[model samples]
Target: MIYSEKENVKSLIEMSLKVIRMYDWLLDLYVLDFFVDDHWEKLPKTWRDSFRDMDPQHLGEILSNKPPKQLLPLSFLALIKSVDALSIPRQNTYKPAHKIDLKNLDNCKNHPRLKNLFLKHVKLKKRHEISMMADVVVDTAMQTGCNAVIDFGSGLGHLVRVLAYRDDLYAAGIECQRQLTEEARKLDLELEYTAKKHISPEAASKLHRPLHFNITLSCYSQLVKLPLPETMMNYGLIGLHPCGDLGPLLLKHFVESEHVKFICVVGCCYMKLSCEGKQQGYPMSDYVNRLDSKLSFPSREIACHAIEVYCERLMKGNYKDLKIHAYRAALERILVEHDPKLRHAPVRSIKHSDSMTFENYCSLALERIKLPLPTSPSVWSRGYHDLQQWRRVVVVYTLRLALAPLVETVVLLDRMLYVMEKGMSCEIRPVFDPKLSPRNHIIIARR
Candidate 1:
């Protein structure tokens, strides 16, 4: 029985790999044809057929003169051009700040997370990305005519501070980490001081709009169950790269609630999402259950295969992992430039890590393929260096890069649908380069 079970599991893994391969091929085709070159004729017929099925507009016109049986490249180009017209650009810019880096490092004694994160990743000049993101959210809120903004998972007042700068837009940040929130409060003082220093008396007088921001370090999951400030319902809610299951939960709140005029969310970490109030799994789980009630996570077999594929890619070369968010943005850039089929590449769960030697980890990985170890475990152990600090930086960076587009797309589409469902008029556009910030994509949904 045990042997049979093991074999069954192995078979399932292989099947899952096959599915992933097909999925990756389709994504790669999209990246190659749409983002890189307009010439769709270079793709294989099987790929062309897949594109036709998933996105006919991309291939139909080029193939219009040609028989359905024989799809040509130029035909595919015309089809792709139509789809490209409909596709939103992930890179765009808004008004550049006359002055960047509003707060000094010495002044931000209280906001340790903000200070540490900014110091570690965001430099004085490059830090414009954070402020840029904040500006986008704030601008969107202003256009929507919202008086307040609720930023969930706000680390250190990056978005809150920007919103507070505006006289008409009141802002509140909901963070689960009390320490981080406290730190952000301290940083806000520095921000205020810096503003006062820079501003003339008249400008200071103009800045007197209560720069009131509050932080509550409680789980967002729990927050949903409780009665939040009624103001939350009235304000535009935005969460930049809310991780795993958290992002989707925000979506449900925005969808079910009548009070919110706008909710901008970006989600990442697909595998980490848990069963919320009604679903048994993420994404397909709900659909599967709705169909026949057998809703569950990707079977253990699928999980193992995913891990193997992920490990194989990492093993292919020693590459530095970018910041999780930045990495997410970079991956999107790569995808937009190279191939989309790998969009679901294995994500290393930086939020969770365990101690294992490189050799041990590799051994475990190879076991999945029933392949022998290429080198002796002793030899493999010699070269491995686990730098926790470096890994943390890279993990967050890469995670941001990988996650930006997926989460952005989900949030944007959800908002678009929400507008349609509510009989409100709206349009959404990507407002920044995903490469600059993993939480880069901005939805300018106007109603």
Candidate 2:
């Protein structure tokens, strides 16, 4: 199944061109500050403190030699015909029809199952979508008559719970974090108790554990283990989000192994990957099947351009007065539900921490904007607190609205195409609820 060098290069070039387009779009937006919010100044006293010395302007900036917007979500090309579906947010709702809760299928989260984690300030929807999409892949594999599933980057075992809870599917999850795995194991014990006792209303407990989803845990990589594949011979396939470099590793394994019958992979965080023996940036040229000629280095301001392109789309309507909560709501909508909207700028204060002293992150943010600071600390603090929370909403909302129309669409499309060339089939669809997280779209691909 090794593709000829020319074919590989061609595919690489196509994917590279796609990323470049997204980069160009983002670069434009950055220059316009269309992506920045009134509270952007709060970044300095809060999150920006850690990277202050490293040139804040350089963070998330596009590179002169790097490819453009290489890390797009998966909602674009795979579900283009249903593009309008992207306009709705998927965060606030997780209809039970979309999921089967181990306890009671009737009371599932109307949004994606993992939405609550965002409230706890965990890894946003970006990571959550990866798990849900992987579930679809696993479901497809099971429907196709496969029995087992191997989940890479199992994290807290969210994806594993979704796949293994069913009696018909046998699943195993591998995670590198021991603490998270331990937590997941403890959670598993709680689930077993729930399933055994919660058969009736009389069994409900105030101190109940989440219903158990059966899945084994391990610490193997595609490079180090054939057991995952060997065990799947008569069963199912290996499904993974395979963030960054792990993607290529999965591909290499899929091609090299005979036991694996299917692979549904959704790759992200490309700038964090290495290729052809290099690190920190992707090398599309190394994996594509063919190309007319080696492509040149992408533009340096492409990320800004992509951001601008996105802003233009997001600001199509009356988006002049977006607040922090609204902004967050919008982002939650886009990431979870793929809803598209032109959100206004949010005016509020920003809060940094729950434990430490209150510094009115948003007051500083207003100061950065050169606005007069309110005299009363309580009023200023309350205003700023509400504003800061809303500022995050605005920031992510602006991000999604600006990027949704084309940039996010194009970049994710390229990823789907890349999967196709590697001999895998894919389906890219929107998840519900955007404000819940910015990284929406469930990308399910199979080999």
Candidate 3:
């Protein structure tokens, strides 16, 4: 019985690497290459035929397992099961923040901001993340003997504000963006000013004022120079969805610093991580580095998307935005014909709107890419082919998304194992609902 969560995570990591090695070829295919490179034909004929004419609703059902068929091949179904089994559950590991009572009533005072948002400033997703994340941060801090939390990439100090309210805990925010750091300070003050009115003078006086630092961790010198705020001898590093390499940087600090005794951070934008540079983010563990399977930029990009949320959209049969992929692919093919060098050219995102047409999308995209747009209706009518095959685009894309969780699992496991390699205990806790926030796995570690 693998009763230990840590052991279970490790077991999953080992298994994911084996599975990924087998499927790395498929994972390497970029969806953008669909129309430009005859990507539809590139897919295994059996796989293509299975989903060729499937309804969007049916495809959704098959993806989310509403019900399945001989519509999908047995081997493909087994592969899907293999990927699903590797993914960590996205249900919150700790109890809901509202239901959890603080252990020390004397020191852990409930902040008004925790329950009552200040003027609904935070979005629904943001509120759920900070409140739940803070609870886990506190719980882990208490367990690991960390008295202070230093949040990296702490935009707006939302997490810091919640943590600062706990009299027993000390919290500070480090943000690279100067504007956001200043705004966080202003908001922190506003929350403090309002919080003072609701509590006793004694309780108000006990409120810990969190320090905000405007520091970018671009170099090790800055990291080493990080001063301990107000004689806090021990502290934990934390982040609520630190983008790209920031989360890994925090983990790096946690492993290297004696002062950083604990960490609870969730990472996003896996595609931005450095794989070849000195501060490489992927292959953090020797185990992953030695694996025959490797994560490509396209795979990392795919891994970053919210599969669960998308699966829900599929289940609901919301295929309205589905045409965008086929349109973009058609445009890509057109661009390549116009200029072979235009292959995979950067095109600014054109927002989906009821008023927007395929031609309108192409015109805007062409304008941004500084390419000529077709003036003749005949050209457009003959140029883009088989737009009716949009469902096939979704099918292939959905198939790609099916493997996203396994990619995410592999990336997270590499981080966890990296920390463990340095004599620290580590685990990936699904602290947020994936539907609400996709990058929900919080990588936690302690020395």
Top candidate, metric TM-score: 3
lDDT measured at residue 41 in model 2 versus the true structure, 0 to 100: 46
Worst 10 residues of 2 by lDDT: 56-65
- Choose the strongest candidate by lDDT: 3
Of 2 and 3, the candidate ranking higher by TM-score: 3
Regarding lDDT, does 2 or 3 come out ahead? Answer: 3
In terms of lDDT, model 2 sits at: 0.41
Instruction: List TM-scores for all candidates, in order.
Output: 0.48, 0.48, 0.91
lDDT of 2 by residue, 200-259 (tens): 344323222222223332222433444544434543334444565665455444444554
Clashes of 3: 0
Model 2, C-alpha of 383: deviation from truth (Å): 22
Each prediction's whole-model lDDT (CA):
0.43, 0.41, 0.76
Off by over 4 Å in 3: 1-11, 96-114, 117-120, 353-356, 375-379
The clash numbers for all candidates, in the given order, read 31, 93, 0
Q: List model 1 lDDT by residue over 1-447, tens digit each.
A: 011232332333233333333333223332212223332344465544444343222222222222344444553344333333322345564573333345632233323333343333245533655556666665566667677767778777666665665333567777777787788777766656665554455655654222223444234344445444554447677777676566655655555555566776654444455644553224322222232221123321122122222323344433333223222332233333334554444433232124544445434433533444444444333223222223332322222222223222333343344334444444444444444443344443333
lDDT of 3 at 175: 88
